[model samples]
Target: MKHPVELLALKQTHEQCLAHADALGEALADMRVRALDAASYEHLDKDDRRLLDQFAYRYTRLQDDMGAKLMPAVLRALGEDIAAMPALDRFARLEQLGWLASADDWATLRQIRNAFAHDYPDSAQERFERLQAAASAASQLMDCLGLISRQMLQRFGDLH
Candidate 1:
């Protein structure tokens, strides 16, 4: 790739996201094994609750940073004329270029991440359900990021 420096920077960001995701997953592993429902969430110790909260926050941040920041930077680095395009169009272009499996999935992942911003203090059940969904969506986002990274390396040549 002509922009090897930019590629290296993107790789660094990718590595950071991977580390955050791995840490969050490790924290959630024990709590997840318990099959948490709303009632189950209520019974969790302070530390476990904190971990769950971190998972929700960090996952959304990861998704947002990747889509809004890392991905657009990547597309530009690859010489895609995406400066005037909306975010959806950029994703569509990435999909068309075979870097992304589905642009719709990327958009849906953003929607799912955004849903986590709402607070359902009045409905514990709804909040718990949202958390569950966010966790699953976060996993999917991580997989998609991995796929995109691999594709980028294959096309641009791995700098590392």
Candidate 2:
């Protein structure tokens, strides 16, 4: 019942989401390593701080973009009303679509995103800890997205 072109676009977006998820996983691992190293040093050198800052920025940006792409795909596969659904309803839809286990963690991640976007400079230590936590949550979310993409491909077959 879906148009072939639309399906193709969805497939492409799904693939991109999967790829971004992989990148996020890698970034999360890197963040953990950096956090450990920073902790071991007991103080961040200027270069170390800069690296952490850059990594946190890129990790958050990529995670947000992945979510942005995913929302559109969900709308395409389901319906536009999904955009306006309550958080619980949205989570249920995402779960039904096999894209997430639950939405609770995602809400936390979104809060972290908002914090990073709006109030990152309150304290370096606090921001670092927040970014680390966000990285972990984003990693899990990316895994869910990857699973959904796989399920979708299996259900719909390869578009190309």
Candidate 3:
């Protein structure tokens, strides 16, 4: 039998990615609620805005890292040609395998991740909006990835 160390490592990484993705999703939801309350109640204080901005930045980075982790595992699971896949095509294939919801949100999340990582000095509000969308998509992606990981584990038996 194959040693299966690589498969086991990929599975572990997938689990970690899902955990971080879920945490980021929860933080984003909380931030969204706070944002809505602030809008309804009054303008957010500078400190509150800063907090949201920071969370958004961190969450975007987390999602990006999770995606990077998931992609290689997904390629291994499918035994497919990763290079042949376009961004959307890769997402779609994952979605078909129950590893994602759809390509649209995943693509948007990638864009948001790029913006947060590279585009500095953008308004807090803009970043917040992007984060909100990315968070929702990340949540869905987490669910799908978690399911895929579980299935993989079952197929190969538990990793030592």
Candidate 4:
């Protein structure tokens, strides 16, 4: 691939992914210091709520960028035609290339992300459950980003 521009795009996407990953890590770490329960969740402090918002926003952003932008850029850089490939197939191909851990895990994360997008105002329990599941799944999303980052570094070397 004799395309410096593609490399530049890939580097930019990789940087965005890393930024999301770092934010997610910080939010999760700050959150873990004080665990949450049904009662505690009902009342979160301003900072805690902000952290939650940060985590939720970044989780969605990271996955969306990976699936929508980064994945296609990566495939193109690797000499694959992804002009018409669906999202899941893109994940499958990344997994095949050893850039992703499991396409299934990525799909599960997508489901969790979708849950976050919808609002059920009258259902606190449902929201709490989703927060619980998404928090756990958020770590997995981080892991996936880490894997892709390493693979990118190996393939492209010092994207910065």
Cand. 1 TM to true fold: 0.88
Q: Give lDDT per model, in order.
A: 0.76, 0.63, 0.62, 0.84
Candidate 4 segments whose C-alpha is farther than 4 A from its true place: 119-121
Q: Global lDDT for candidate 2?
A: 0.63
Worst 10 residues of 4 by lDDT: 117-126
The better candidate by lDDT, 2 or 4, is 4
In the range 18-107, model 1's lDDT, one tens digit per residue, is 777786676567557756789866567787677787787778778877887778767877877776899889888888878778999988
On residues 117-158, what C-alpha lDDT tens digit does candidate 2 reach at each position?
A: 677555556766666666666766666666766766676666
Supply the global lDDT for candidate 4: 0.84
Top model number, TM-score: 4
TM-score order, best first, reads 4, 1, 2, 3
Residue 83: error of model 2 in Å?
A: 7.2
Cα deviation in Å at residue 16, candidate 4? Answer: 0.8
- Model 1: how far is 124 from its true place, Å? 1.3
Task: List, residue by residue over 29-52, the lDDT tens digit for candidate 3.
Answer: 666666554133246777666656
